[model samples]
Target: MNFAAAVSVALNALRVNALRSFLAMLGVIIGVGSVIVMISISQGAKAAVDAQISALGANSLQLRPGSSFRGGVRGGSGSATPLSDEDVEALRETVPYVIAAAGIIQQRGLTAVVDGVNWSTEVAGTHPDYFIVRDWDIVEGRAFTVPELDGAARVAVIGRTVANELFPAGGAIGASLRISGVPLEVAGILAERGQSSWGQDQDDVIFVPATTMRNRLGGLSTAGVRNPVQSIWLGIDRARNMEAATEEITDLMRVRRNIRIGGTDDFAVVNFAEFLRARNETESQLGLLLAATAVISLVVGGIGIMNIMLVSVTERTREIGLRLAIGAKQADIRNQFLIEAVVLCVAGGLVGMACGAIGALVVESMGQFPVSIEPMIAFVAIGAAAGVGILFGFYPAHRASRLNPIDALRYE
Candidate 1:
């Protein structure tokens, strides 16, 4: 039989048992839908993470006290000891690739008061270079001057959140606010930087001079050393050189800290690029698992189609025998069944694609997750559906083709 005639026969068969064909296609619908939804969610999560990381600035590397991978505590050994002004200066003078570095000391429970309104916030003690490294912009007034950092002046910059909390009607700059009971003048108000994906408010802190934090707020202590600096922030000339610069800094610190060759370095260095890559890998793995689960449903659906097709062959035995008597070849009978199976799957796939799109939109609306339906994903799903039909339809088609013409004609 020709392609058109085979398709017509397949369509007529499915039309005679509309409900059964629909049922057979149900599994494909579910499988395709699940894959699309899972992939969309994963992509959304990755996008959010990437956005947060990008907000941290490009070519940035964070040097914290402990090893990020192994250290249980942030301030523990095997992490770098509290970064200091001396370390910052050494990096500036010695490392040509290093563009800027800032020592940071973080102190929570710092209270900011303006008039009667009071807000407790985290205060980061850092130098003027921190602004450059962090890519933070001042909306009002200016960052603390070099002279102020050198003199350990009690000056502070308030984040947008802190500014709003302290001075709700604006005009908080040049105002004096007490940090840990010590008075400091608010020199600048940072522009709004929204909340992070982890739900932490990024703009709810205060910035101060590193010197003032050490002198007044005291230093962070771990195992009783009173380590002053919590971490160091560095910006390199190029992001591509982040790894090389990180290694160079580690070597320099190891020598400066007198760490033996066999001993593990106490400080931890983190690159955002590494973090992003690891996150992407994790997302991809999860996506594959979800897609596999959906594919399993498709296989089950295919089995259903096969079962129905076998029954169909048995029910239409007499018709097959009559067609064979009227010059229909075994090949023609086989093609008819095959086309019917393919039609069932293709139709189901189209319907499944539509359902998947609607489902994605619903998820996006309800969960507020960004859902992206790539055209490639849709095409893959459609192709898989068709493949399932062919794979499952083959056995039944072969069985029908091999049936004895004499027995089929004699069936009651």
Candidate 2:
């Protein structure tokens, strides 16, 4: 028989045992579907992590004071010692790579009252240049003026979450909001920045001038340190400048704070570049592990296909004998069986592709994690499924081809 006729015959044979054929292909369907879903979701996670890491800006650094060793009971960075405005100035003067720096003071449990609607949130006090250090954009109105930041103006910039909660009806810009009984003008509304990598909400706070927070809200005091602010933020001129800037800033903080050499640092300077690299590496490793799991499933699916094809050969002994008796060559029988196996796998692959797409969509709608479909992934899955069929189906096809015509005919 010709190639087309052999394919037609093989298809008819599958059609005759429709239930068995469907059962045989089930493994391939599951294997391909799982692989596609796993790959797409892993890739999406990697992309999301990278994007979020970049949100912090590659050249940014956060400086926080170290422990104070008060009464032999030491607490961590935030309350140990307070960073001052002088530190910010010294960083600018001493470090050439440090372009801009700002002092930040945080006050939590501040109640913001707007038209009798009160919401409790944390407040941040920083210079006007803090926005530049953070690479933040003011979506409405404008950023604080130098006069506002320097002279303790009662103007505040609110984050997206704060605005949405305080002014559900919209129009947050230029609104008057009272914070802890102190009325402050809303100078700007920040754009939405959903969440941090550590799952903290980024848009749930307010930004006021450092002077305003100190004077109006009362300066934050620490156990051992006389005056304290939460942390200092700095922006380097370039990504490559982080290492040198960190060293210089550390040295300056050491000398300024009177920290002795061979002793622990009195302050912490955190460079975000190292964090970015570590995050990317983590994502890549996670993707590789998931990909390995997917490959293992495919291998198991291939084994299932082999088992079913072998059973098929045993059940079709008389049919093979009859074909051989009709002057059909061994190669023709082999080709016919191989075609049948390939068709089954290809059909399973198609169905699996559809299942994978549906799974991805369902997962995405749940909003728990990121999932993005890459079309090329589906094609690769289908090709692998086809390869599975060819590899697993060969042995069964060979056995059928080598069968003795006389013995096959006499079998039950």
Candidate 3:
């Protein structure tokens, strides 16, 4: 018989056992759906991580004081070395690739009060260049001007979370909020940044001038150094190699800090470029693992198809013998069974695609990790199902084609 005739016969046979055919396709449906959902999750997670990295700024480097050792006891990271405004200036002057730099002093557990509403948050004091280094944008009002930084003005830029809690009625700009009993005018409101890669809420802080924080907010240096800071953030020139720039900054800092040659450096430089690469690599590995698991599920589904096809061959033995006796070729019998398996799998694949798309939508709507479903995802799933049908259906088809007409007739 021709291929079309074989397909028609196979389909007719499946219709005669509709319930059994559907049951046999169940595994394929599940496998395809799993493949789509897993892929969407992996892609979505990757996109989120990339966005967080971007928010951290391009070619950004964060310099913090390293641990200090005293009396054979090691202090926590950033506790030993006290950074200062002078160090920030020296780095900006010495490092040719440093495009922007800022000195920072940070304090946590501060309460902000406006009218009767109060909210607890952290605050940071930094130079205006911090906005450039951190890639932070001012959505309302403006950042600190040069005069504001130099005069230690009591002006503030609040993040989205603080804005929402304190100024639910809007008009946060030009409004007054008191922190640590110090009243400050809100000069700007920061654009929303959802979360950092480390799971910290990025949009839950307040920003003020570096001088204001040191003189007014109570983050003074223990070493009595003038204009001391907790950390220094630098934005490197995009065209320069980040590692080279980092090395130059480290050398400059060591010299400026009076650390002798061969002595352990008392500072740490965090290269954001390297951080992004590491995060991407980790995400890629996770995606590969998820893909492998989905593939295993598809294989298991194929095995199910194989078992059902074997049962089908046995149950239709008398029918097969009658066809063979009526001058049906062995090749025709094999093609008929193969077509049936493919049709069943293809049908299941179409349904699975719809289910997977719905599942993706549901996940996104639930505010879980983002999900991305591409057109290629559907194509891959459908192709995988067809391939599974062929791989598993071959053995049963071959067995049916090899049966002797007389023996098959007598067995039934």
Note the clash tally of each candidate. Answer: 8, 0, 0
lDDT of 2 by residue, 4-81 (tens): 898899899889989988988888888888888887788778778767766775579999987776667777655456
Q: Flag the better candidate by lDDT, 1 or 2.
A: 2
TM-score preference between candidates 1 and 2, better one:
2
User: Which pairs in model 2 have colliding backbones?
Assistant: none
lDDT of 2 at 129: 73
Tell me model 1's lDDT, rounded to 2 decimals.
0.81
Model 3 / residue 120 / CA error / Å = 2.9
Clashing pairs in 3: none
Alpha carbon deviation, residue 337, candidate 1 (Å): 2.9
lDDT of 1 by residue, 14-45 (tens): 99899988998888788777767776776776
TM-score of 1: 0.76
Worst 10 residues of 3 by lDDT: 217-226
Would you give me the overall lDDT of model 2? 0.84
